[model samples]
Target: MKIIKNILFLVVLLSTLQGFSQEILTKKEALEIALENNFGVKIAKNNLEVAKNNKSIYNTGFLPTASISSGANYSNNNQTIDRQDGTSTSIDGAITQSYNASLNVNYTIFDGLGRKYNYQQLKETYNLTELEAKETIENTYLQLFTNYFQIAKLTKNKENLNEALSISKKRLLRAKYQYEYGQSTKLELLNAEVDVNNDSITLINANQLLSNAKRGLNLVLGIEKEVNYTVETNVDFTNILNFDELHQKMITNNTTLKQNEKNIAISEFNIKVNKSNYLPSLGLSTSYGWNKSQNPATSFLAASSSNGLNAGLSLSWSLFDGGSTKTNIANSKIALENQQILLEQQKITIDNTLKNTWENYQSQLFIINAQNKNVITTQNNFDRSKERFKLGQITSIEFRQAQINLINSKTALNNAKFDAKLTELQLLQLSGDILNVEF
Candidate 1:
């Protein structure tokens, strides 16, 4: 009775430990964690902020620049002077002091509206960064989704292996009993033992794979410490997408396309900026200054003080810069052309990818349905074979074959479901609809 009590206590303790170790990590939770901690997403967000700051008029050269400067200095020196009339004079501890302060302002009065174009360019750059950030976020989401579903797949595979192992164990027990009663040969019992060993090894490997997969997911979640978690095994494939609608969304909302459009706009603005060099630029400059100086020993004018305000206008035109301006404008136009070409190429590539992925997703769904029916059929065969083996109507080898078939069918079904979900996710990503998926 005492031993029984100890065994019960140990069982309860292990159950508690297992419960504490397992965490339920849902897809939403994983994505939320990644959004907050992913390095790529963080960098993209920072880039967006920098672009937003640059979009300001002050950074675009439309605002005047103002600055203030001040300085003070003191010096002591021993001096000797020789007069022109043949008289010599010496002075000791001659002290001098000087102070100066100034405030200056400069504004570009005109530059062929270059500042206006530049400001527009900055705004376009900000828009580009926004798209870039969205792209990064969507990519991250897709990665997490893939990893999460992989875990689910492995989890289901492990369960299938476990079930197979359990069946092998039961067969081993029946073989042992039959041999002890002289109803089975020793060779048959040995074969059952071997099969049990194989199943156990397979299950061990499955467990190891599951552990490694979990560790990979933890890394993606940016968790420095390994966390034990179990994900949901059910794959959802509820999003039914229409091809025409998806294509339209891809054109209007695709991050890469939007970014390319912004780039083209910026390149056009850049050409304008370079062309502005052909016209003269006028600038206004104004300054207020104060100066004071004193000297204890001097031949003439021992001290001086000055204070004034000054203003000036400057104009500049580049008549010949070795054709630099022309080259720059040409390059800008070429860059704009490249952007347009890339946009077209991307549209084609994305369209083809979308069609392929959509077809693949549909095929996966059909495969899953077929595998489901196969699992049911194989499971019935295994059950019947188990009964027949017990009645000596089938050999142990035949029963084992039936069991293996069941396991394989289940594995294929599990894989098919997850693969379909992943393909669907790819479709959404291509359409830029992944960003709309709520965590």
Candidate 2:
């Protein structure tokens, strides 16, 4: 019975593997998986949550603090006592007990409006984090899409390899038949066998490449288990032949650019926060307390009780700090200027990037169009060469060349399509619209 159970488990495992090995993945499905499971996305989202929590007003010391405390103590000690009649007595132990309790409240009445500025700084910082998370998502999706399309190309190349191998096999068979009929030399048969072997090896290598590509794609999707899957051979592009619209969108919506703007605002607020140190600060504080004392030696005469409320207003100012505040303000001004420069530099960089990717998209489109006809012609040429080789009208070398041409054309077209997909996604990314990826 144990052996039967083991056999049943083996059968089930095999069935699962067979089914999983035939799974197909789509671009949108892969994107959804990466968005949910990718580590970087998860970390960015956590950072955004932290920033949001930091921007809270109550948490940032905006409100007053109130506390209540109670304490008690008892003491015993030896003491000497003297009376006015010139008689003295030594007490072995004298005991005393006391209790006190207080309720206190403190509030910052004024601090050059520093708390208000701090609150604005935190709000801007939170906005910066939000944009940073968006940038991470956009960049990660580009990488994922690139890997996915790579797998698509590898799949097509594998298909091309298989077709070439099949052709070699048929040609080898034909060569043998011709030699047996005294129509081909022994050298021709030998060459035919060599070509067939070479094609098989090439096909094997192509399969390995395809497997690696699939593994890369799975890693991008955050998948840990090894399973085989096929990707669709479709990458589409729309050529706008214009960068003006993309440029405008990028200026308004680009994540990094917007993040830089937030940084500038934070720096301006920092200047205010630093300058606040020059002004005097005012504080309001109040306390209510109760105290009681009892003496065991003479409880009737030494017992006492006091309860009251006290309040006060305090003010302070920093007269000097070895030029530290001045230095900080100057540094803040410099930092603000630097941030504004970076913001402008980023605009220039993004403009250059957009133009380059636009040109690349157009170039890939041209290559795809050119290769489309080339592949059709090569396929026709290969079919004819196959017939000619079988009929002894062409040599195996000539037929191999035709097969290579067909494979090259097909591979080139696939690569061009994949390149176009990359540029299209890049353009969309620069335009701040990558999350809307389709097809």
Candidate 3:
């Protein structure tokens, strides 16, 4: 009795643990966790930050640059001198030291608008980086959402299987009782036991599949180990959207298309920047320094020991350079044209994708409606079959057939619902409105 009591306590404890583990996680929470913890999104965000830093460096070109220098030097000299008496004499000079320090400053007065254009280009590049990050995030979110729904659907499937297994167990027990009372043959009892074992095997397989699905969800959510969580099975798809409206939204809001547009703008700016290279560049530079001679005899002591300042404006024009600059300008123009062609292609692709997904969504909705009706019909038939069997008007085989039909119908209905919901999600994603949809 004590051993039995312990077994009962263990079963209760396990049941309690499982109940606690089945806490439902909403879609919003899952997405938030993925965004916060996903490694790929973190890497993309870091890349964008690097691009922003690069832009800042380029922007510093507008600020004046200054520098300071200090140095020490020593020198010695040997020479021959002619005296007044017409005799040559040799003289050795001692070492001398000097120290000097200076500061220099340069400010750009003009550079043929090169700096402005380059800054603009860098700004555009920064924006492109941000767009790339957004694209990465959106793609990651889509994957997460798909996996979340799949796990939810699988969990529901397992529940159905478990319910069917319980029903099989009860039928097995009834068959055994009938056999004991001589109301049924041994064959019927054996068949019922076989069905129960088969159901148990199916349940085991379903449990394994559920575990795998949970692991996949955990991977997407950036969790290290397995976690027990439930997904909300209710996804409302009552809002019907027009294909034309979806296409329009995709054209306006698609990140990839917008990124390509930015690329075209960048290419145009590149051409301008390359063309600016042909014009003259003008700049102002100034420097102040103290100069000292290690040999006092060779230095002009009056000015050498003093500081001097100089400032001047200079202009440079590149007349020719092996046609490289011109070639680059032409290349930029070609790239811009290519981007234009790509933009058109992308628009067509998006339009086609939206149409395909919208049609698929409609088809799945129809399947779901049909499956729902079939479920009702199958359930009614199963009820009537059970009644007929109990009244001895039908065979046990017929009753089992009805049960199988009902199970199949239920399974099909569940699958159809899942497919319909997935299709809806795809449509919303294609329309660039998945993030805006309320759960």
All candidates' lDDT scores? Answer: 0.87, 0.85, 0.80
lDDT of 3 by residue, 74-168 (tens): 76777666767999766578456788889889887777777788888888998999988887887777788778878777777777776677666
Off by over 4 Å in 1: 1-21, 71-98, 293-304
Clashing pairs in 3: none
Per-residue lDDT over 225-322 for candidate 1, one digit per residue giving the tens place of the 0 to 100 score? 45467888877665666888988988888878888889889999999988988899999999999999997765477899999999999999888999
Per-candidate TM-score against the hidden true structure: 0.89, 0.91, 0.90
lDDT of 1: 0.87
Winner by TM-score: 2
Model 3, TM vs. native: 0.90
- Looking at candidate 1, the ten consecutive residues that score lowest on lDDT are 1-10
Q: Of the candidates numbered 2 and 3, which has the greater lDDT value? A: 2
The 10-residue segment with the lowest total lDDT in model 3: 295-304
Superior by lDDT: candidate 1 or candidate 2: 1
lDDT of 2 by residue, 1-439 (tens): 3563576467558856865777788877888899998888999999999999999877667799999989998988887777789987766668888999999999999998888899999999999999999999998899898888888888878778767776676677777778889988999889888987998898788878878887877777777745477777776665543688888889998888999999999999999999999999999999999999887663445788799999999999989979998999999999999999999999999989998888888888899999999999999998898789767798778988998999899989888888888889899999898876565
